[model samples]
Target: MTQRHDIRLGADIGGTFTDIALDVRGRLFSTKVLTDYAAPEQAILDGIDIVIRDAGIAPGDIGIVIHGTTLATNALIERRGAKTALVTTEGFRDVIEMRTENRFEQYDLDLVLPRPLIPREDRFAVRGRIDAQGRELQPLDEAALEVLADVIAERGFGAVAIGFIHSYMNPAHEQRARDILAGRLSIPISISAEVSPQMREFERFNTVCANAYVRPQMADYLSRLQVRLKEMGAGCPVFMIHSGGGLISVETASEFPVRLVESGPAGGAIFAADIARRFGLERVVSYDMGGTTAKICLIEDYQPHTARTFEVARTYRFCKGSGMPISIPVIEMIEIGAGGGSIAWVDAMGRIQAGPESAASEPGPACYQRGGERPAITDADLVLGKLDPDNFAGGKIRLSLDNAGAAIARDVGDRLALSPEAAAFGIVEVVDENMANAARVHAVENGKNISENTMIAFGGAAPLHAARLCEKLGVERCLVPQGAGVGSAIGFLKAPFGYEALASKIMGLSKFDAGTVNAMLDDLKATAEGFVRAGTDGAIVREITAFMRYAGQGWEIPVTLPDRAFAAADTAMFETAFKQRYARFFGRAVEGPEIEFVTWSVKAQDVRPEGERFVLETDGAAVAVPARRGVFDPASGTVLETAIVPRDTLCPGARVAGPAVIVERETSTVVTSPFDAVIQVDGTILLVRKGR
Candidate 1:
């Protein structure tokens, strides 16, 4: 038999599962394994073994490997990274601790801010100064840095971060300090200029500190993964998906692991955007509900929204300013603690609440019966008949119904004075409402109406709850694409080799220096292209963006720029573009204050083949029901005999009226009584309102 070399593999390590997707040519084979938190890579190897065996192929036949993980994000949230120190310009050591000095919850008298990653005692100061115009005002205090290095070595610090005032405008001071420290300490060092060159001292300093904090752990894990894959005879080039929905070489990912903070969720957004493009849907809302959390992203014109900064681990009810801010190119989205393994309990107010805490894969939900006693969303789902005990994960792990009921009854039912089934219903409703409210807030913040967009739901648990969520949000349509269980892993196969580089240079449109602007943009373009060229020699496409705001504004909005040389005559064009974008964002543009460009971004990517168009069939024969089971219907508030149909048995255009459960190996789609399901030509399940 001939061996094939066109095989690609994508692996995603979430909090509760390690999902693997293998693409041989165009065919996909996927599986989900319980996450081995102690040794995450071991789960990946185990999953790879299963898919390759089923595909009748050897590990050597794989051509490339793409991986995304939440390890960096988890390390930050769990505070499990190495002991790290921060070095900043003298008198500015408390910038991260002070934050922006704004209250996230202004009315709360007992509000407490999230602690900085590096403590005040661990932060040291050195005398150095740089002006706002890329000029050094004072030389770096090398003597002070040398003395600090000795203190750091004595204290046994594992990593160091250096952030100097105005480092984004001039990096010489910060760079010089790093050289001095690197000469004495044998530890990882991160500088703000290289990590995040945008303005704003607090955000830039925090970002570099985060990068250094997670550097050692991420580097070690990536190295071990490479060695293990090689030992398994899969000598393919390993790449990593970043938070910006692009692929980068492993070497780059290791150097800047902060870019991988939201990598996993970014892939899910890319998956939904790709589907929207194929279906010609201009507006979309992507819903991804995995084991530990659920992510919601808004897509416009077939592209997911992008942002320059995002907060991590929001400590105050997922509020914007309540978490550590990391300034990097990222896909903007809102994530809530609503997922399969999220815990459910009664709060101080005597109301049932779903979690910001998860049971994870260690013990998982009560139904897994590993040792968990707390009731989780998954346990409630099982009690409500949304999950099949004998068929979960293709029967690899059997669920215990008795254990689920006991746990729910003990944790929630007794307190609420409700039956076990009633308690289960309450848990499910709370989580579903949480997700729906998040979607509504996300849309309103973006000046969009939630009901006008089609929902594209994925992940292992999204399909099971999407119909009810749609009903809550007034959405009329939802699409559950094939391979929805391992959506992020499959998205890795679709991401392009790309990178975005940013630099801050404030310039008023009236004083636009065509020569200076051209030179600055050219430098940024080269830097971005260099990152992409490391992975591919294919044709490259470049995009330019200028972050502009009226003079004296604290923040700016992005304006697209043509990828061409600029001249003084184009100043008016810049003004006009800013006004148009401003009006689109805020309803009207102000004619007064002069507009100034604050930051410039250039993105380079390898061109990918266009996806084929998807056409839906409006009419089809009803699919056969192989069996029927009593499932709880939230709308009717009673148990109904629902049709249980295997997904593989449904042909394209086959229709099934609710209430029905379309079961597949990785997940299940629950069509509520108010909605009907139809299989599209590409095997995507389309759920629409009963009369729509």
Candidate 2:
């Protein structure tokens, strides 16, 4: 069992599937397994066994393992995490509960805000105060903290979160409180300053509480995964991908599990960004449709858009401000509960509605014949003849068309007074429109046109619906990359060892001090670099950003700063940058309002080699069709004979006309009647609109 440094493994545990990808030098081997809820790690192990066997490599030969999961997010959403207590400043005990007091749904008088993670009884307040200028306003009551620690110990709380007023500016009080609690309690303790150091008490407090809520569960899961992997002969160091689309040591992940909330989806964005870079596409709409959820992200200039804060478990139609805010660096994306297993049912309004709930992997879709009585999106896809009944998941799990048809007929067809095929078509159309509307909203929010961007579709279910999605969005081209089924797992292998550190220090342009700003930025840079160094000693790249806003404004926009030391003369440059960015965001900038810098961020990452350029082939010879099948065409509103081509047999420069199914082991790409498919030099399937 000789070690092979070139052998790296990447695993992503989604809600419905655990995808494993093995990279043997430049070659890739991948597989997907049904997620085991009771023992999630078991699915990863099973997937690993499959890929390693296919790659002809032993577990001991693996050099490194990169893993991502949705466990932390699910815990918060399901309220299944450990019992947690919140310790905050006396008057600010209700910060998380109070939220920002903004109405996400203004017209609904009965709207109920999401309950805080820590119940009111579990929240304790102490005597402490830190001013906005990082100055101590009141001394922390050490005795109060010691007494609270004893109370926490006696109550058997699994985790504790401490978030004092203005802790982001001065963390001395919060640190002291955590030290007192750690000495008395054996449970994990989290401080808001370390979890989310930016301003805004509501978001910061909620972030730390969320971290503490899931700390015990995530730590236990990650520990068990490592132990199991070691038992199976994989002794390589394991790293977890964070929500920022970077690899961090498992130790860091355990301490800051909140950062891993969007880890799996971040990988998908990174995969699409890499594909965009290779193909030289400047603006790409990254569409990832897995079994339980679908995510859409905007990638521009060969990088996925990033944000300093994002919400989790949106409860109101995935509306902004309707979920728990996590103030951590993350890749920005819009996620909807529209996936293969998303449940579809007729609403009270007699309209077909897809999910914010899913069957997940346990029962899966009705077509899986796993005791799921309800019809799901997968059942609709099956009933519509988009999926092959005999060869799903490479035939490892046989699909039952009878089961699918029966479920749809019982639930939707009978209720809607339509045949199963028609009902299935209606269901698919509803879900697709849901996704398309989401994409449209996301692009408009970002001030971009959806039709102007090329789409890069991945995940098992994305390609099956991508062609139709393109038609709806008026997108001219879509790229279904190689190994699309396990795109996120493959993304983990491509991610760099990186970290982002954020801090808050209010500074007005009129009173700007270059020395103070430089010192703060230097501290942040060192902190980010230290985290990156834990994983690699390679050359590092640094990026700096300033969150800026006009005086008396409630929100700010990010302005990227030059990656160099600033001087007193640079104040005007900073003002100019903010003005330009502000104009771009709002179409105009106010000249009289004084500008201020609210927050600063530093991101550091180890450099990696760039991928080779991909040349798309437009003119190619038609490929031989292995078979033909009766597939439903939405454009024609009828089932038509379509060519089915084996993906493995199609070489570079191969082309297939519209109404074709490019079949592969992991997933299939359905080229609709309006588009034609061409095999690129890198084995990517390019779907272009007819006469484009």
Query: For model 1, how does the per-residue alpha-carbon lDDT over 622-678 read when each residue is reduced to its tens digit?
Result: 877899999999889999999999999999989999999999999999999998999
Candidate 1 clashes between residue pairs 3 or more apart in a chain or in different chains: none
TM-score of each candidate? 0.99, 0.99
Q: How many residue pairs of model 1 clash at the backbone?
A: 0
Would you list the C-alpha lDDT of every candidate in the order shown? 0.93, 0.92
CA shift at 567, candidate 1, in angstroms? 1.1
For each candidate in turn, give its C-alpha RMSD to the true structure in angstroms. 1.8, 1.5
Which runs of model 1 end up more than 4 angstroms from their true locations?
Answer: 1-5
lDDT of 1: 0.93
Worst 10 residues of 2 by lDDT: 1-10
lDDT of 2 by residue, 212-289 (tens): 999999999999999999999999999999999998989999999999999999999999999999989999999999
